[model samples]
Target: MGDETTHIEQAGPTELRDPLVRTEIKRAAVWIGMTLAVLAVIVLAQPLLLILGGLVFASILDGGTRLLGRVLPIGRGWRLAIVTLAAVAFIVGTIWLAGVQLSGQAAAFSATVTAQANSMLAWAGTHGFTPGEVQMDQIGQQLMGGLGRLTSAVSSALGAITSLFMIMIIGLFIAVEPRLYERGVAWMLPLRSRDRFYRTTSRMGYTLRRLMAGRLIGMAVEGVGTWFLLWLGGVPMAALLGLLTGILAFLPNIGAIISGVLIILVGFSAGVDAGLWAIAVYVIVQMVDGYLIVPYVARKTVDLAPALVLGAQLLFGALFGILGLALADPIIAMAKAALQQNADERSGGKAAAEP
Candidate 1:
């Protein structure tokens, strides 16, 4: 043993024992770790997205609970319970009251949309825009085929009651005692990073709450306003259109374009006047949301650029499907908040160092 120790001492430090080499090794490890992280995210995209969906849901519940606290003077648990129960009741009541009617309208709406598409194609052909009958038939077939595939995929995945139930359960567990999870995550981080992590998470949570508040409010206003106005104007499937519009509102730019197309198509089926009226309603609702709700939300939260959000939506949707599309806004907002906080810290550090 003494001879071995003597031999080791005489042999001197190895590469890993050298300080510079150790530092380089650490740097390489970091790069490797980052590469692995990226790979993991790609491979586990679906489960990660589901977890994110749960977090988003928790943010909504947390926001509602806080809002109720201002008025109800109740315990957090009680407030959360109230909010959850209210949401469940609203969903159940809406379905119970209008399920059959809406189902019938949905089928009719699909037929109406197809008929309108054929009518448009026919009109275009008459105007000498496309004279080939075979081409028109092919185009129509392709459009219908794409729509069928999209509808089937969405119904099978996004409409899965089990997925939604799992999300709600996850959200409730997190919302019940969020700090526990927050601290648990922080515990996994290095001591020096925990404070920064906490700050970033706090900012993210605040941004999410404000962003969701605006989105929910906008959805309610647009849905109800569209329904009431369209119904008053004798538009068929007003309820279904309004419902679609409200849900789509959650998706920002893409949602608006889709809902508008549906509204215009359905509106024209009734008459030219009704079609024009639908356009007017769409304009008014959008104007209210864009000028009012968006600006108010921007002031309180991170104001994401439209193009950036759209790009993120497209990327996420393509990568992770519908849930990613629905979540792109919130994810972008949280990322923005974290980045902004990091910038602030760096600026502050520079300022401190300058003196």
Candidate 2:
């Protein structure tokens, strides 16, 4: 027993001092640290969402600058200036044209939404799923409480406006000096990994640009088509519904579902005919987007799995609310590209270049 004890004593120090054991301990430490870091970031997800919004805005500006560059024989700075001015003009014009109509419809839209809610409650009561007034009140309270929490986490309206300003400023800075940020990131990595980091980032940028383009095209088409069809059908709140459709289009599959529900509810508030017409419009818009627009965009961008995107949206929405849900697909796409590159590296293969 004494001999065994002595042997273990000797082996313990030896193992501690051994280079391989030390290396493994260091590796374990690194993994643990990395895991904690990731958890910390997830906990602070709101600020991360803000940063992500900035990056998305930067990508949009950069994309516009690039397009303008191809068309005009001008310097990049000049092209970016032109593109920025045009974007501002377009936004102002849109608001000027639609603002009054949307405002006028706002109260009616709210009334319709409330009526739809009451109808849903009535149907539930008929089906023997009725809740007492107290229970309904509690549910409403809980929902408002949840939304209040989300608002606090994301900041209030003024805070949101400030965030928008910050995002635009950050985006502008990034667009103006993209290489500076890229190099700054690369500088943080080990010298040996810098080349790989740059390559991965470049691929990610290309993927992001294409993804944004596809999304913008889809939003425009969906918004315009829905508005035209709803107007022809004389659907109530057509302008508001159209606006929601456009904004929500940014969120891909999940957004479309929510917008469709809203449109149907508003349409039904008018009449059965209007409801049917709205349904037809919804189906037609989705069909065109699915069969034509999305396919063409998918060819340019990475094809995300519907299930994966939906899952990510749910998870992100739960964790980070609306902003998280909106950006979920892009986050997933970037992750997919990075993971694919890593897998290729492990297999001693090269990742395919972006189209």
Find the candidate with the highest lDDT and give its number: 1
lDDT tens string, model 2, 113-136? 777767877788778787633233
**Would you list the C-alpha lDDT of every candidate in the order shown?**
0.83, 0.80
* Residue ranges of candidate 1 with Cα displaced over 4 Å: 1-28, 93-99, 125-159, 349-355
Q: Estimate each model's TM-score.
A: 0.85, 0.85
Evaluate model 1: give its TM-score.
Answer: 0.85
Clashes of each: 0, 0
List all candidate RMSDs to the true structure.
5.7, 4.3
User: Residue 161 CA error for candidate 2 (Å)?
Assistant: 2.1
* Clashing residue pairs, backbone N/CA/C < 3 A, model 2: none
